[model samples]
Target: MENQQNDVKYEEEYIKNSRGVELFTCRWVPLNTEPKALIFLCHGYGMECSITMKGCAGRLVKAGYEVHGIDCEGHGKSSGLLGLISNFDN
Candidate 1:
């Protein structure tokens, strides 16, 4: 889905990872100009990208950067046992 906040555009999607788990991903991009750079956001443990890091993403977008984030396996909207990392290989 897509939405606009001020001059930034926000979008979210779900994609299956290599392990076949559906992961939630989101991005914020400057709507009126080419982004200066790309920023990949990494949320803390037990934190999800959309809600937890939204403000940070917005700030970056306003600074002329595109920000992307993801809810890792077993966290947030991702499909897996909550709080379980198992292994990082996947």
Candidate 2:
């Protein structure tokens, strides 16, 4: 577990959609190793990906997979009204 934690690499960033709302994003990957696969995770409504998805993401990274997560609009550090999804199509 300690070795896995030391080998894990994580990053957080933000991206804007067409509507210019910033969405919080994160990535977890193993250091000095090529990922075997990629997994994208979306947190539940009213939850932030950073908090809700960290455990799973860490495990995946430790297993040599790249894990990514994004906080939808209105959640986490994303720009929008809390607990609201402005558009289902977005």
Candidate 3:
């Protein structure tokens, strides 16, 4: 995990119509001072990526790994409401 004090910065956003609904997303790009090795990320539940996740992204950026993530539609900030919606559907 990348630690604080690293000037690494990342982008945050959402992915739309991914399978079903929009996906709240985030991106962490390495400094690009050197070639990146890999990428790491996690999908959200039903909301836009928040500061908490941003910190995580920053860390990944500092680690020299491209980071990408998505907030699961109808879960994160994509669209829809809470589990109640799913319950009703079921």
Best-fitting candidate, scored by lDDT = 1
For candidate 1, write residues 1-90 as lDDT tens digits: 999979988999999988788999999989999999999999888878999999889888888999999998888888899889777784
Q: Candidate 3 lDDT, tens digit per residue, 1-90?
A: 333245554565655583466556666665645637656566444444545477776666676776676665565555655632554454
TM-score of 1: 0.94
lDDT of 2 by residue, 1-90 (tens): 123457887788889999898988988878889999999998888999887888888888888899988998899989899999667885
Model 2 spans > 4 angstroms off: 1-5
TM-score of 3: 0.59
lDDT of each: 0.91, 0.85, 0.57
The parts of candidate 1 lying over 4 Å away from their true place are: 88-90
> Between 1 and 3, whose TM-score is larger?
1
| Residue 77 local lDDT, model 2 | 82
Top candidate on TM-score is: 1
| Models, CA RMSD each | 1.1, 3.6, 5.6
**lDDT at residue 1 of model 1 (Cα atoms):** 94
Backbone clashes under 3 angstroms, per model: 0, 0, 12
